[model samples]
Structures are given as C-alpha cells and as structure tokens.
Target: MKTISQVSIFIENTKGRLANVCGLLGDNNINIKALTIAETPEFGILRVVLNDTEKAKKVLKENGFIAKIAPVVAVEVSDTPGGLAKALKVLADNDINLEYMYGFVEKASEKALMVLKFDNVEKAIDILQKNNVSIVDDKVALGL
Candidate 1:
C-alpha cells in the first residue's frame, strides 16, 4: 500500500513555539505541503506533511523538539458537495474506523486531497482501492 510520511511535533502551547518550529524547518529548506495543529490547554501536536520527511525529523530533533513520523493515507476526493461523505461511506461500509482527518485543495487538480489516519491502514487501503477511491502516493502528497 502507498502511504505518506506525516511528521508530528509535540510542542508547548506558548508564544513563538509554532513560529520557532516553522522557522526552523524553513531555514533548513524544508517545504511544508500540508499542516494541521491539534491543541490542548498545555500543548499542541503539530502535524505536517513535508517535502523531506527524514530531513525534517532530523532538523526538529536536533533543535530539541519531539518529533515522530507516521504513515498516513492521502486520497483524492471530488471537489463537490457530498464528495467527502461518499468516500467516507466506503470506509464506513467496510467497518473501518477513522482516527482523524484533514484536507486541502490541490492547486493543480480539480479534486481535493484528504489526509486520513485509520485504525487499520493496510485494510483501509485495500478497501479504498477495491471501491475505486484514488489514493495519493508520497511523491504526489509531497508535490515532488
């Protein structure tokens, strides 16, 4: 199954922390393709898809940030009403549980891209493919 490497950074909920992380990556020539932050009262998990996963992880770790990489599925959904629902319905019917999801529009394509985490990635990929859903590979996800 094809997957994208998502870099997640555990950051403090303090001023300049987000900027610091972004600045660090930018300074190192890492391009962020997609990003989302899930925050609590005390801290946040900064999840991002970057052009260079290993390099970004190394850069963040060397800067004293706690970063981890995980495989995630990126799928192309139609850019229309019910598009997301239709794709999700395929997963639902297959009894696949979704952990979380985020999305962004692809400037070069008419479809929107959804990044999803599933309880069973391999099974989810198989089901999605069997149902004719388009899965984006690492290269496409990173814009490479």
Candidate 2:
C-alpha cells in the first residue's frame, strides 16, 4: 500500500527517558531511520522509523516501554525551493488533513524524504498518486 511502519513510543517527560529508549534500540542493533518527538509537560510520544520495526518494538516492550506501530506515508520531493510546498498544496486542495510530518534529506541524492501522517492515509495516498507525487515504499524508507 506504499505505507511505512512507524513505531510510536509513550515516554515520560523525565531526564534521560529519550536517551534510554535510544540506548535500548541501539543496544539491540536496531537502526533508526527517522524520528520525531511530540511532547507535553507530562509525557512525550516518540515516533520513529527503524530498520527493524518488529525487533525495535519487541525490544522496547520487553524493556517496559509502551510502543505501537502506525502506518505513515513517505514522499520524495525535489531538493529545491517550493518542492515541499507543491506536494503539500495537493493535499490541502483535496481536503486532506495532515496530522503531522517530518523530513530528512538523502545525503547521496538530490531529494528530500518527508514522512507524513494524515487523518486518512489511504485517501491521501490515492490523491497524491493521482497528482503524480512520488511515494516512497517501506523498503526504501527503512533503507532495507
């Protein structure tokens, strides 16, 4: 479905909580591809794309962390001004609501990868595809 698996972890807003999660994943040989943190005064949601989603989730859970997998869309846009804007405009025009998004540039390519969460994932993908936007698959997004 051209969707990527993202692991969302519920974490306390305490010192070293972030580091502990990262350390657990790293110690287990799980490589993180991309990540973002949504936080409040009490806690934070750590969203991450990892090379091994299942393994990462298992490791985190075994360590007493709350983690779950969610589907997200990854789009590749030109590494130039307005590239992102043009893609976003397609969604806005089609009445798609963006939940949140994060991006990282490919060091070996002149393209940027955007990880997007939409209220309607399937609809968003269909709309974006019809509009000719490039959607990255799970394998590519995870660097597998």
Lowest summed lDDT across 10 adjacent residues in model 2 is found at 103-112
After best superposition, candidate 1 residue 57: deviation in angstroms?
0.9
Residue 111, candidate 1: C-alpha displacement in angstroms: 0.6
User: On residues 1-144, what C-alpha lDDT tens digit does candidate 1 reach at each position?
Assistant: 398888999999999999999999999999888789999989999999888999998888898999989999999999899999999999999999999999753432788888999879999999999999999887777778
Worst 10 residues of 1 by lDDT: 103-112
Candidate 2 deviant stretches above 4 angstroms: 105-108
What C-alpha lDDT values do all the predictions have? 0.89, 0.88
TM-score of each: 0.95, 0.95
RMSD of 2: 1.3
